[model samples]
Target: MGSTASDEDYFQRGNLFWFTVITLSFGYYTWVVFWPQSIPYQSLGPLGPFTQYLVDHHHTFLHSGYWIAWLIHVGESLYAMVLCKSKGITDSRAQLLWFLQTFLFGIASLSILMAYRPKRQKRT
Candidate 1:
């Protein structure tokens, strides 16, 4: 059996630690922006004060940040799709997965795709 271009261009998943941390951070931001009243600020410890302050004094800031963050994620996801195509990741499933992961995890996912260096083929 021999290697194929698909094998060389397969997308790699990002690090578990980074993926988890980024997911949690995004979740927190979502909660803070959409359900600020439900957040137990004191329980957040150091982040509590900042979170409360933002919600109290600058809610628009939080709202803008949330939307902008998602917009950036959308842009990054599109770029990841392009990167997949350029790197010869021809599988539609792989490209869709890349887009979704990058949409959710942003740079955590895109960084992995960016780091990919397709294997060079031999000039037989």
Candidate 2:
């Protein structure tokens, strides 16, 4: 089947949204991991207490990082559900699998879907 203009627009917008999400997630992770010293600890907002606790007690920055990664995973899982629906994936098992994979693997699961997605067929 041929894609209509609206369908193409929807596809482009979805792609752009996913790309933006992934880029921002990666950028935040990189900044936290590589240049954390550049971050102003005093202005960490809600994370200030946790950051101080971890620094003063544990002497490590891992707890905050773990929380951030967990938050990202949760967001990815929610996005996976929306993605499965948008892609017309009706099989319950398939949707569940993708959701779990996306939660566990993040953008890797999205890449897998893009790589293996079936091509649209032409109408006779």
Candidate 3:
């Protein structure tokens, strides 16, 4: 018996998705890290509502955005790990930069897990 899945029916395994996620992070970090001098800050122009709010509220916005983005990255990393398990895929770094990404994400995940532990309690 021969069976094939259509493009729509086909989906990537967990490892592939996690790998891709890490790869993208590696590339992003490399771009900003190695090319710090070459990278110019993109100007958002005159202070708009967001900038105005940040101004009115002070520098808290900057810290908030920074931390929020970091939290999001951490969440995505965890999601990738879960996805990898769900898809039964072995994740690996295709490039050296991926190593950095994995390490960084791993640290963040560990820190979060250490700070918060959730356990399922059996209903007696």
2 or 3, which is superior by lDDT? 2
lDDT (tens digit, per residue) of candidate 2 on 27-70: 75565556666656779787666655555565445546756876
Off by over 4 Å in 3: 1-53, 94-124
- Which structure is stronger by TM-score: 1 or 2? 1
Tens-place lDDT digits, model 3, residues 39-93: 3344434524444444446555555654676677666566545443333323343
Give each model's clash number: 0, 1, 0
Judged by TM-score relative to the true structure, which candidate is superior, 2 or 3? 2
> Relative to the true structure, how large is the alpha-carbon lDDT of every model?
0.83, 0.58, 0.41
Show where candidate 2 strays beyond 4 Å.
Answer: 1-60, 114-116, 120-124
Question: Which residue pairs come into collision in candidate 3?
Answer: none
- Residue-by-residue lDDT tens digits, candidate 1, 7-36: 433767778999889889988888999999
Task: Give TM per candidate.
Answer: 0.87, 0.46, 0.35
At residue 42, candidate 1 shows an lDDT of 89
The candidate maximizing TM-score is 1
